[model samples]
Target: MQNHHMITPCLWFDDQAEAAAQFYTSVFRNSKILNISRYGEAGQEIHGKPAGTVMTVSFELNGQPFTALNGGPTFKFNEAISFQIFCDTQEEVDDYWQKLSAGGDETAQQCGWLKDQYGVSWQIIPRILIELLNHSDAATAQRVTTAMLQMKKIDIDELKQVAASQ
Candidate 1:
């Protein structure tokens, strides 16, 4: 059978699959929950989840497919893996940064990286940062890189200022 989504990233949650899916869909535009699967009695012994409880949530965020699984507490999210949000303006960067880092670990934020309340690592980056860093001039790129390293939420204006100062 042909599948709509070929490779979906699965997020392992400790009984928070549905809640997480709801939150994610709310954050991005053109996103919604597509389907849900509940635990069954057949897997009670190994899974330990009660029948009818949410086992998995299939959802989309800005057209990207993802699955949140109530896989117990066997795994947790870390910074090793992260999702990048490329924004065209500073407003977009600020909006995502504020929403995603509302109750996140403050200490973990650096270089446009933040850990959300669910411990999901996200990078809120502006498109200009990429262009600046990949500029033909090496010194300008270094300056912008230094500025970015000192910031938690990337500032498009600051990056622009740094790039032009040289």
Candidate 2:
């Protein structure tokens, strides 16, 4: 923790903090579990978790620090907050899309957005999409946007075709 980021996201889960941490670490490269703290009798009255149960798990995903807490089902994750993964190539995008969306809500997939099994929303975006969307020609950008709006996982080749047509 010598040069940690200024902010780290802390996820709230009912009782899957450790499982979630392990799953996330497995999904991303350059990731690992940093620490784990279990519940103790000190806060038994309020927390209500049994002693020795996982309380918080500190982990890293592709070098980004995150903490998962077994804070009960008081709050749940929604689409309001999401993590965006910017990919440089179609292979990168496809790899992430397949891995992160496994067992997730298929109904939530749209425009490169998906909800994982834990209800955490993620946006798997490609760098080419951003470039096309910001093209100098408004018409070309519009076409790219229109094409993108119709899909779930982004297809870099298809987007390039659309951009070229315009």
Candidate 3:
């Protein structure tokens, strides 16, 4: 086990901490559930969860440490925060897009962003996108950006084509 960073992103869930942790671990390589802390009688009145129920689940996704808390329905996930997965190839982008959006809200999907079944937002991006978007010529970058804006799951070939066209 490796020592993780002091600051880890904590995900708030409504009794789905364990399930979301399992799902995320299965999706990413080199990921696993590190620990689980259960609720206790000490804070039963305030938490309202069963004593043995999960309170927090510490996990890792692709070496990034994350904590999921079963904090009840007091809060909900929104687009304000999202996890971005950068892929080196189109295949990698497609694979991650398909897997992450499987049970997600299709309507919320645009420009490679989607809200998963757990309501967590994710962005599946290609590395080439950054290069294209940062090209020396502003026109080329603008073309790529325009193509991306019209897409749900980004198409690397389309971006390449737009960049190549006059």
Candidate 4:
């Protein structure tokens, strides 16, 4: 059980660390490149790769830390568990929705999940999800869950209204 906030997603790529880091930092506010390191001589012989190849690159997206590892094409990011971002308003959600889906695809899950060009999964959920989940009634949570299943990029106000109803 990994805590979402405490974790810094380490993404593996086929030599796209710099490019991917640049792209991601440009999209989100409060995002910046932390550091970048190339394969030193010690790393070259052990891994059997080139000496100057990119080893890792770190970046923060909206204060959340992430590391992009240039570890070749051995592994990939699947839709198993994704980073769920809490957006304050529809504009914030829409901005991320557009940028993230720029070279990616969109699904109809009420802004729950999307896969970026690097095959990274992200959940663009609204801030209301926390409120709904934190509600006193489990039934409300269930209702909100059911409603979320029918859409993508969740509408916060709609969920609030739904929770207020039967």
Clashes of each: 0, 0, 0, 7
Residue 33 error, candidate 1, Å? 0.2
Writing each residue's lDDT as its tens digit, candidate 1 over 104-143 gives 9999999999999999999998999999999899999999
Best by lDDT: 2
lDDT per residue for candidate 3 within 1-166, as digits (tens), equals 5554977999999999999999999999999999999999897789999899999999999889999999999999999999999999899988888888888899999998998999999999998899999999999999999999999998989999998986
Deviation from native of the Cα of residue 106 in model 2, angstroms: 0.5
Between which residue pairs do clashes occur in model 3?
A: none
Pairs with steric clashes in candidate 2: none
lDDT string, candidate 4, 94-149, tens digits: 88778886777554234468888777777887777877977889999988888887
TM-score of each: 0.97, 0.97, 0.97, 0.80
Point out the worst 10-residue segment of candidate 4 by lDDT: 103-112
Deviation from native of the Cα of residue 130 in model 1, angstroms: 0.5
Candidate 1: global Cα-lDDT? 0.92
Alpha carbon lDDT of each predicted model: 0.92, 0.95, 0.92, 0.79
